[model samples]
Target: MTALGPLPPTAAVRLVKEAVQDAYADYGSEASRWLDGFTRQGGQVFCGAGCFGCCNMPIRLSLAEALIVRDALNAEKLAAVEAHARQVLANARTAPDEDVYVRRHRLEVGYCPLLDRATGQCSEYESRPTRCRDTFSAFPARYCTEGYWESLSPRDKRQYARDVARTPGTDGELHYIAPLEYLSEPVWEAAAGAMDRAFGLQVWGDFWVLVSLSARPDFMAAVEAGDGRAALKAAQAAGLSHPMILEIE
Candidate 1:
């Protein structure tokens, strides 16, 4: 973790914002190429409206990405996101394990905070993080439902097999797709490096928690005063520690 010790608060934020824009632009081009290849190979994409299965699962984002999302929201949406984040953080604090907490949250909540309940679409679709953009399924949308995975108990492998057999649409197999896999190693490495350099730490965590924390006036103030480390620590203290930060290798 390289530290960019004390500078103006907006300096890092500006750098991160610029890096996020550049990275997402590159990611868009790379993702389009992958989709084109999949189509060329006669593969059909099943992701579309009313298919919010993937949204129910946890989505992580870099600090820079989260900041961008925060900047894009209006007052009303930001308030809703804050309320949702409080619930998520409260739930996470009581769970015995982070993974279990997230799984249970998905089962109970069943949608991302950023998702529009009425239309079943992302509110900030244009500025969505790479994690959302990269997610796709080679199988039909029905097979991708969270219920298929969440309903099965860990002890019931046989029951799981039977359930899979009973499920229609899928050919009793799962083939998930991630366009990031097809991106060049150098491209990903550059993106990762850019995030690390901009944020001082190789920070990545749950999108909802990150966005909620980023929307905080105090957190932004701390970061603007050249104390992003303190802002992140405050987030951790507030139960935003799950999906812990990772090293940019």
Candidate 2:
């Protein structure tokens, strides 16, 4: 916090990643033990390598994570990201709330840019954003598919629940690996602190929204120079500031 003299977005990303590295590692170890204990009690984890059904939705992230994503992408994937971001941005333009945005983005905007459509796998699996890494499903992969879940009637849901090792949350969402979420929280906290110290404000939001902002050298420069207005102006012009899509505060 002491030496924050106009650091570049890249520098901020390093700070964020480094800040969370050990915490993430600890979370992984704890999560493994927790999973072992959980499954011993007849619980289950249905998320697997080929299950990319959860990828087709709106997800939030910090600018530093976005930069990691930008750096990880190739030219083709970069273009794909921009294209997907445009749809996400467009969907945000009229979305009444996050729920609507998530559903619309899932069924409308469709799969993630990095998703391998044929194999139902993430191409950038290793360097994927925090949100992607955070989300996990304890239910059958088909349950993770929003459309399939939506098609189930109330009675059908009840009947299915009777036979499943359910860990239902507030929204009937099956509890994902609970420990996985703990790891991502520190990353967000570190990213928020790093962004705040570097630019005097924080940029956090939907993954594509952050990616759009991160890829723009002008946007990056504006924030690096502590020019929030210019950065906000640029992002707004591109329709990336819908409250659901992003927050530059």
Best by lDDT: 2
Compute each candidate's TM-score over C-alphas: 0.75, 0.84
- What are the per-residue Cα lDDT tens digits for candidate 1 across 43-114? 667788767778887666676777778778876667666666666666666778878776777777557777
lDDT of 2 by residue, 1-249 (tens): 011112244675666555545444655676677678877877667887778878886777877677777777766677677778878878888788878988899989998878998887888776676777777767678877878867999998777666454463212334455556864687777777877887788877888767766776667877777777888887777555666677777
Pairs clashing in candidate 1? 9-224
Report RMSD for candidate 2: 5.4
Model 2 / residue 199 / CA error / Å: 2.4
Candidate 1 ranges with C-alpha deviation above 4 Å? 1-9, 150-174, 179-192, 221-229, 236-249
Q: Return the TM-score for candidate 2, rounded to 2 decimals.
A: 0.84
